[model samples]
Target: AQSVTQPDIHITVSEGASLELRCNYSYGATPYLFWYVQSPGQGLQLLLKYFSGDTLVQGIKGFEAEFKRSQSSFNLRKPSVHWSDAAEYFCAVGVREGFKTIFGAGTRLFVKA
Candidate 1:
């Protein structure tokens, strides 16, 4: 079985500050990884993904992630965040079906100026 755990249920950060979110995964083999962002009452959008290759991958919205095989982790990072960046973030493991995906519970982010 494959699963993801986000230790922080919620986080709050000030505008123009650096941000980092923790993600841990449990899988029998190397699995596809992704990070998605969802605004309040909205659907999720893919931030980034790691399949096979470079450990570090970049994505939209000025975000990046590194796949660490040793730690079994893929953490998301943003050097400086904007107020609009405030939203719910989810780290997910890709499971193969015909064509589908599953997501974590999510971590709500609040931005205070």
Candidate 2:
């Protein structure tokens, strides 16, 4: 079965500091990669996704991700982070055929002043 792994259970970054959240996936074939953020009491919001084409993709709210097939990694990065960015991030993999998505354990981001 396909799976996603977020190595960091939680990460702390100062406001305005650069941020990078690691994500690795395991799948037999190329699958869709996604980065979703969920606030304390809100539903998950899609931050970015990589299906094909370009290796690097930009997302909303100053976020981006790079898909490296060789590394099986789809890491999310931001030049600067805000206190509002603090939330739970989940890395997910989806296969088009069955339309099923598998999410990682999730990484909680703490933005310190």
lDDT of 1 by residue, 1-113 (tens): 66899999999999999999999988777789999999878888999999999999999999999999999899999999999999999999987764346567788888889
What lDDT score is found at residue 21 in candidate 1? 93
Worst 10 residues of 1 by lDDT: 95-104
| lDDT per residue as tens, model 2, 2-107 | 8899999999999999999999999999889999999989899999988899999999999999999999999999999999999999999997667999999999
- Predict model 2's lDDT versus the native: 0.95
Q: Can you give the lDDT of residue 36 in candidate 1?
A: 98
By TM-score, the best candidate is 2
TM-score of 2: 0.97
> Each candidate's TM vs. the true structure?
0.93, 0.97
Residue pairs with clashing backbones, model 1: none
